[model samples]
Target chain A: MTHVITDACVDEKDASCMEECPVDCIYEGGSRMYIHPGECIDCGLCAEVCPNGAAVALRLLDPAAAAVHGPANDAFFTRVLPGRQAPLGSPGGASRLGPLDVDPS
Target chain B: MTTHHPAPHHPAAHHAAAHHPRAHHPAVVDAEACSAALDRGETLPWTWYADPAITALEQERIFRRSWSYVGRTDQVAQPGQFFTCEVGGVPIVVTRDRSGGLNALVNVCRHRGAQVVREDCGTRKSLQCFYHAWTYGLDGSLRGVPRGDREADFDTSQLGLRRASVDTWGPFVFVHLDPEPAPLTEMLGELPELLAAGGIDLERMRFHHRVYYTIEANWKIAVENYLECYHCPVAHPGLADVLDVSPDAYELEVRPTFATHHGVVRDIPREAGYPVQGPVVEGQYHLVWPSLKVNVNPGQPNLSFGPVHPAGPERTTGYLDYFFGDDVDEAWIKAMLAFDDQVGAEDTDLVESVQRGASSGGVERGRLLLGSEHTISAFQRFVLGRLRED
Candidate 1:
């Protein structure tokens, strides 16, 4: 299991997680930094460094919110990773990206 | 390497002229010509958003060939610390070498098309292809091949990861796919001076906040929204309260190659229960053309919103950086973040609405209400004129 930064990090942007990561798995974004699940050794350095307390270390055994991880990762990757010139929450979650000037209904 | 000459009447030129009543438009105009357009007050064409053909052309001429901001110097903090990003939609990797120097390479591996850096970011002693264990050094040198000796004639040097032209300006790390790209400073024209006014001391500043929003609006719309502050009074009540609102307070400062608007609005009524504190800079908004913003709030740290996906037409990603002078304490920083989030929410609402409305019928070119929102008019003219020309 890996540690993930959630939307809570958006306003927090506390980079303590970045400094604590021994492997430096955390990467900064526009408003928040993220821990790369692939590279995160799951050693939990991020959880220690986070200032606003926005990082979450995922454990598969903890069946509470495991189901939401996939969607959350998708949201973080698509919205936080690549970043659109547009706004992520506009249509809530419009997968289709029309032509720039084309006003999608 | 295929060298293609700039043919007579480049395709971009024809497309630029088609948008306006002009007979001809050059594919690539110099900084001076662009400045002249700004001087004459001629509205630039809107092809930066509408023309996919022109966008494709820019991918090669602008993004591929120019030094573009890829990430922060802090991204690759140590050897093998690497991250994947896209330049002109081409995925590339930014890594730290054993020598601690940063390098950018195409994420695609030589043996297989698999991405060298599967994760968005991480620290590794070496980048190994997940598909076949083909490895690369932190400095982008080819390091290993699982069992390629059977090939009989395998030159490892030739298989080194593809290198890109990478440079650093301030905290921003930029990469250029073109082997011989123009220097980053030259491409920035007069942007540095504008950023300086916002107290952009790169060394003094450290990474504080990062949030990415994937908007449905064309990247241009987001840029346009950012370039102007006309919507501040109505759309951003929280922000408008801090800056003095008036035509004189928020006038467009346009040079040949740049344009910016700064103003101040009275603080929002505390009774209104908005997130604001201390003496805020009275409506000082600086717009560094193309895609950058340096926002100042007197007592608060200067906030720079550099939209990385400047030309991502269909979608846009923006980088928001908040820089605090040493005088700022942790509590102040937390309060500032609260204020920032509130203002960001307002912007998100307006921009998302505009993205949705642009698609509705009867918006070919929305009428501009001058005086109050002249920044938008200025931005629209610049964009339309730039697009209209080749």
Candidate 2:
């Protein structure tokens, strides 16, 4: 199962998870940070170092909430929210597209 | 961002007018009395200690203009070694270049203001922003842009990391925000000679450890507390036991660029765990204006120096770097550090209480009792001198 960023990270976009993620899949967002689902190695390193308990394995979440976060995380990269037309992919950093200004689940 | 406007008739203003007859209300600094008090040897009005406006003024006029101490030279001794610190809220990284030259560069990335060097200390061939892959050479030249080919008009030469003036004296490293600051040697003015005269060997010292404390007091209050030993007998009994607390045993020298206190230690209690056994020794304390303190304890080859940065109007964060010679044993170093921690705890409690008193609005100002507290008065004068320059 892949890892997901929970509600605990909103407004507290602490980058410890980004630093700990071996694949560098954790991407920053407008309000909260996002972890690229396709790129995540499911190593669980992010969950261990998160001071706010924001990072969690998808299997650990309630089935209903996981269903929402799974799509929302995918949509962050795959859907153009405000300024752009296509998914962000791995444009090196989330900051390049600037903040999406959308709340992350 | 929410903006807070003070009430037209703030309670602090009313209190200042009623209780403090000498209060320079609103501005809180009476130019005439501040100047006269220097000669009279009295402390500045207490309002200076608690005013947010005054703290802002000090940030621009004092901290920015002074050569603030950043860290020890040995901290970034090797090429590519670097450490990040701040002066007046501006983040800076000090690195030793390939040619053995020390360079201080603003830590912000040109692309999105992200800090390029996140760690406190590390060795790196280049600094790269984590937000994007924009990279800079260790010498602070913008080396690479992740997608440079796509940006046809982007000029990399003009976007190199901003540099600040950096210098080193003995084991200390200092940085100045002003591009053209007076030579660090000139600013130090006889401090090196004075330390040498006091038997401090700059060559033998090596950095040991750093302890930080966040005090709920204005940065000036912490500094004033350090400038004078007047409260030693009452507040720091532990410190008084090692260093002579008597008025006659202490001598304060107020220089143009710095202030110093030389105190002869009382007889070392054989029971006291002093690593070096010797006759009575002298403790040297020096303060370079704005926010750097250097302390050399008696009976050992030890040095502690650091800066106090203002976190807010009534808050300060300070760190002290402890250094000792190669000859000192680890057990003795630990004992010395413990002793210092005990003394620091005592001072912290005292300064925090003084912050409360200054903010209470009942007390107008403090009087600097002559002879013992001249250094404190001198410090006030220096602060006023800098503030008035603008």
Candidate 3:
């Protein structure tokens, strides 16, 4: 399963996760780092490097955490977030698109 | 197991060994045509060797994506043993956990990206990064993290070291950046069998010594030099005598992932500054795709293999880890090492000169005398195709 970023990450965007991700699947939104559901290799480096433990796999999350963050994680890319006109499908690497002032509500 | 190398391909017709299309296999290589092509020279422009941008593309497309030899299996024979190396310039640490399992970790910490294992080789209970004291077990599971664990959400399991792909062929250990790369066998083709046919037993090989070489040329230039022996007569007189570097007799076999050359050793005195005649009758020089070189010299059972790594666009560096049968005499090993060194030294001079010419901007490209240098043409094509993949 893909990794889901929860509310625990709201403003605690340590961004340490961005540095360790092998596939560069984690992108920075205005408020949090979003893991691309399609691009995430389930490598778990993002979750491991997250000092706030904001990055968690969908399977490992609590039922409540998964129900909310898992869908929100997908929505962050698939349904476009604030300050964005289009969905941010897999842009390959976070470095390419850089940090965005956008995130799921 | 018997190293299953029954017959090293000493092709009576070097032409029969020509399979790659556009290769120098013209059934009957016209001597006049060969002369004309040599005059024209099918070599790439010097920029490929002198340009930093070309080197960057190679690091990304070739080295980072392909599997190359990093070390020998014996380096991690016992549990807790480990060796650190680089694959395409990325730091890697290969470890054997307490459970006897092997792991190829990123070597970079899950923390701020500092390399965790700094030593070249060692055996330890766990890895502790010097920066902030983040410790990881031999299996790559994070074990400890300084005094900062008081944070409510510091989960050690999720923060273990990142892993790459590791596999072995006989005693040769290969690593790839991809977490789970294709099986090493897929990339090895008939190499192991061919090396065996050249009279080497990886099972009997033991760690002897290693010799590192730094050359002032692109890694591709170093590799291209290895693919053919057309210059062996002029540049490597000693090697020419030892490896039957005749254009007509030198054997070249190209597989999908590797290429093999059969060098029939000339019958002569086994000088201390030269190789002895025994165990190995033919010298099998094999290259595995991107950058691995497997050399089986004629002498007591021996094998020395390693990767040609790109230090930069204008420089290449690599090491040959020598292995010989434990029963072989020490003096014989020394002589073989010396002979190999002499040839390597000569090669260093040639490649450096070639690099100078490439960087000089006086030449455009050289046409190939495909008859004797088809192997190089194939390799150059491989490099060109890879760089153009994007």
Candidate 4:
């Protein structure tokens, strides 16, 4: 049910969506931003404000894309990032913590 | 909590969408058999769902003649404020003139038939056709022509935009294509009373949000899905929990021009969808004969209604406009919308599945469990009767 940031945001990390997100579930990757699946409230604000049309509802994604991205999004919060000691794992929100400087790739 | 009636409406006109020449196909639906099947508690032939000839007949007989919901008064509250919509595939524009009167006109330009008033909605003194600049007054009269002086045979006065009947119940506005159609009250039947019973203050309602959607199925299929909730327990589990969709608790009352279903809130409510507000005792849903729907959920003082019209023999399009009280809770509104969206998504899948099966010719007819789905029969009968009249 979380909105997923797709390959459209890979190089263009126009993070205007971060400013509009109420919970700041959007996180910065090296070249993109990933929406923390667990932290997202499914409010759809990120999908509305996304400049490059990167943020999309899980339902709107094609089945092939959804199949891959949904679990990958979960891994971003579960699997440890390159720099972080442990996985992001719902750090409450990303607004105050800023970018974690890593993604699940 | 306060009970209120619908707003008083004044003046009238018609609606718009471009018309295409209906290609006639021969007798497809056997009306007599369909009627007998309904009488015997059987369903109509699946051909009715996929036949272009029958769809054409419905477009002419039912949709064109019926008073269709087009927009709300809030959309055209000020002078020169206008919005365009279609009923029966004919483009229409509704505007408020300087005298504070509403004008409903065929949006098709009198010149080359290019549509005027192209935007979804805006404030403008005069509507002009984008192609030819054929200017029209807010009253839908032809006010200016690009080169009428050059065309010797032109009759500007006689060539003003065509009018259609327009009426309103509270904030809801309806338009008819018939030269002089029956009053919308007749079409509405006891629906206004149903709204009052639900305690929706129609006079105080304002437009909040709209979701325009298209279903890849016949318009009738989509409407039939709405007319009955027998499938709710299996198809719409979330909604089944919120509304007491039990056979005995759900009340379906069918009138000549309309049918309404009232569901008493079950005492076992705990979580999910929207909580019942203090004023709400039940969930009220209504269908005005053909395709217009009025749905008031439990948690909020709101009405979301719209018309479903055919995009093609196998396609349907419509919009649900959500209206709420002044300064209602924003969170409540979002919750209500999300709940509706969840049910709507489920319904889209179901109706589309039905359309797929019906289109395959695998089964001639879809038999119904009359006890739970009588409304579908009533609706199908209404459609067949209307088409038979022609």
Candidate 5:
């Protein structure tokens, strides 16, 4: 299982969890942050030190989210994630997937 | 919980009790070298104390590479929350933009390099350059230029405000001077374990008290003073009464890269468990290399870090912050704030006095008693070693 930042990090994307993760698994996802499950060491350091509860470990085989997590993680590492092309919240832009008003700052 | 242990007498008690690597590694500084420095009354590593050359080197080598604590996440809690802060003297603005993600940008504007946000904090959709009216979104993308079409070869996207490397830990926000810094995780090795043991659940905590002080002492002096409990017995009367500081009560431990001194004040009676969730230690002080100090007091946790704005060899500015758990009540917060004020005021006076005396040049150096002031001696050794390192 790798950590995934939920919508809570959307606008208030404080990156403390990014700094806290030892494996450098966290990456900027436009408005929110994403943890590459493939690279994650599952140290739980990100969740433990997040000032805002924006981080959650995605139990990869969770039949529901697995479809998105795999593609997302791959795109994040390859630096070709579609989310990067346009700003989040822009329609033809980055997907507005993360939390909206949850403040991570 | 017992706070007292019989004081032990040993040759290198200060060396052992302090966080001195040299105590464990005598070869680092030869015995003859120690004798020569001591004979000249200049032994205890003056490089860490009196060296402009080292300070400049630190700004480039150490501060630039390290994850510097810029501000707290709570400062920018709303959709457009924004604040200006400095990390290693680099001005930065941390904003929660319309999109809701926090962005750390050099406070300097892309146009004319004027600072965007002038005040401490507020809500703004985009930061407009006060001088030329060039505006940038919270995410640091250039959103509005005064005249987009006029400038030849003008690429607004290319002219976006430079974003600093930013990361958050608990309620604190950290920024690196490096454009591409080492991940915060690797930089903060074993600190999470230490913070967790001390009961700092970053998610539930809130930014409570922020007190800034301009001290006339080297930043290292404040740091060195903070790492030890030797002065608590003499200087901090209120703190001394509450903390568990008796003979053999303090233990300084280091985890390869980080150094921590655990001193529990077990005898003090609790009012209502601590204000936050954590073990009942009076204080857990952790010092991460370069410039970060976490003082996890029983009721509140305070972090202090800043460049030693060396106006000269004698003057400095000290910036301090205190964070508390969310579950704490307002009354408790107000009381804690009062307590913090007193402690901070007292500390400012004490440190400033030390700076004045040191500047007088009357005392060249002083010896450390083996048992009482081990932490100070150890920290001095650590400072000296880091200064010596390329």
Candidate 6:
């Protein structure tokens, strides 16, 4: 299962998880940071380093609750988000992208 | 572009009244007796460092009430430039308004308690909460609320970001969580004059860099380590080589609001990379109560300002803001920074070990060796006084 960034990170985008992620899969969104589902290696480094306990394993969450984050994270990269049509496949870093202005969870 | 020459050396000026070793430890919570003992050069109980309750008390009584360093005015020099910091776990954002006046606002959004300014620092026309885009003006007035027309009784005029007590002293900006705090200048006492006497130009100093350390020790342990240099001769041989670390040579003056440690530099060794030589340059370390520390080393026109903040009961997060004059060469600055890094590493090792011992339950109280460590005792007394104050 892929790692998901939960609601715990809503306004607290400390991005410590981004620093610990060896693959640099974590990306920044407008309101909250997002973790790319495809790029994550399930290393759990982001979860370990998250100060607010926002990063979690998808398998550990209740299926219904975990459902939103997985797609939301994918939507960030696929750019199926409300305002955009173009795909933003791995832009290397989060600082470059305009914030999606949506809740991260 | 002003330069400062070192003042004349003065020892025996600010020594503690007298040392009086007691056979038995007094009551730990007795503030009056503790003050007297500290006046006579004694330390606080070891348990004070490890107790979680004391940490909470300190946060309420000391950190909340005292003026805390937020950032430099230069950090937010232009209108709409802003930065966020936490004082005793309370998040605050300092911004420069259109009128060039500084404003310190509680960083939490009025909408849903979300942090309005998420990024550490940046230039923003308006602070918009990432949560719902509820926006605030540079002066902390509520500017926008998404879908506000739908609400029947929503009054946008009544809801603005709460302001914290904010002020500036020279280049530094400070905030107080207390609704009404003593003027920052009053709290500073004679620090302005003292710093001037030591040749520190508050207006001309420019930000160089910042380095943060997360230590596995209480915040006080790190602060106490800085308050005294008795550990230097043995624990810090590299530092001792550059600065005179002898107990007789080091001078400490404990004032009502702060403490200062003066160390004259030794004859520069041939191998040492210091750019200036002859007529020894002095090193001054000053601590403004609660959590501010300033260090000015010899042979360099630089100032290191740091604050030790408690992240948890046993964890501390500290960062040093290095400021240097334009004349100081980058190579010499880098070398000085490297030297500071080495000294910091040595200090953290010692402080962490002390933390382990203090938390191990093996010791209840530790002795304060009067001649060299009176400054530490003074610091403990300062903390205890604040903790017990009304």
Interface RMSD of every predicted model, in angstroms: 11.3, 11.4, 10.4, 20.0, 17.5, 15.9
Docking level for model 6: incorrect
Q: Which stretches of candidate 5 lie over 4 Å from their true place?
A: A1-105, B1-57, B266-279, B299-313, B329-340, B369-390
Query: DockQ of candidates 1 onward, in order?
Result: 0.02, 0.03, 0.02, 0.01, 0.01, 0.02
- Any runs in candidate 1 off by more than 4 Å, and if so which? A1-105, B1-62, B255-258, B265-289, B308-313, B367-390
In candidate 6, position A32 carries an lDDT of: 67
User: Superposing all C-alpha atoms, what RMSD in Å does each candidate have to the true structure?
Assistant: 19.4, 13.5, 15.8, 20.5, 17.0, 13.7
Docking class of 2: incorrect
* Per-residue accuracy of model 4 over B1-390 as CA lDDT, tens digit each: 001111111122111111323224544346787799998778777767777877888888899989999988989999879999987878999999878999889999888999877799998656666666566777877755644554688887887789988999888899998769999999998888888888788887778877777777788888888888788778877787787888888888788898778877767884667766546577788888799888888766877888788977877877888888776788888877777777887787777778877776667787888888788889989988888885
Candidate 1 lDDT, tens digit per residue, A12-57? Answer: 7666666545555566555666555665655443554355656766
The per-residue C-alpha lDDT of model 4 at residue B211 equals 71
If the candidates were sorted by their lDDT against the true structure, best first, what order would they fall in? 4, 2, 3, 6, 5, 1
Q: Please list the C-alpha lDDT of all candidates, in the order they appear.
A: 0.57, 0.75, 0.74, 0.77, 0.58, 0.73
Model 5 chain B: worst 10 consecutive residues (lDDT sum): B1-10
Please write out the lDDT profile of model 3 over residues A3-77, one tens digit for every residue: 778778888888777776666788888888888888876655566556687888787677887888888878877
Predicted model with the maximum lDDT: 4
Model 1, span B241-276: residue lDDT tens: 555545566666655434566664344443322334
Task: Write the residue-wise lDDT of candidate 5 on A1-105 in tens digits.
Answer: 556666666667687766545445576655777666565555444654455766655552466665655545444444434535432322221222432332122
TM-scores, in order shown?
Answer: 0.62, 0.72, 0.69, 0.72, 0.62, 0.71
lDDT of 6 by residue, B1-390 (tens): 001111122222221211322222123357787677677665666556656677777888888888998788888999879999998788999998878878999999888999988889988666767776566778888755645645799997888899999998888889998778889988799988867777777776788877666777778887888888888888877677777778778888888888888888775453554554422278888888976888887775788887878866567777778898767779888787777777777777777678777666566567788777777877787788778876
Q: After superposing candidate 4, which stretches have Cα over 4 Å from the reference? A: A1-105, B1-24, B150-153
In model 3, the runs with Cα more than 4 Å from the true position are A1-105, B1-41, B267-275
How many clashes does each candidate structure show, in the order listed?
42, 0, 10, 11, 23, 2
Instruction: Write candidate 5's Cα lDDT for B1-390 as tens digits.
Output: 111111121222111112222122223344356445544434354333344554555455556557877777778878779888776556788898766787888888877878878988887655666666565767877755534544599887787788888888766778886778778888679888777777776666666545545555656666556656677667666666556666577666655555677767655454432243244345676777654666666655433322233333334554556556666667766665555455656666666566555434456556665455555555555555554466
Error of 2 at B313 (Å): 1.5
Candidate 2 is scored at a TM of 0.72
- When only the first chain is scored, the TM-scores of the models are 0.60, 0.81, 0.90, 0.88, 0.58, 0.78
Cα miss at B352, model 4 (Å)? 0.8
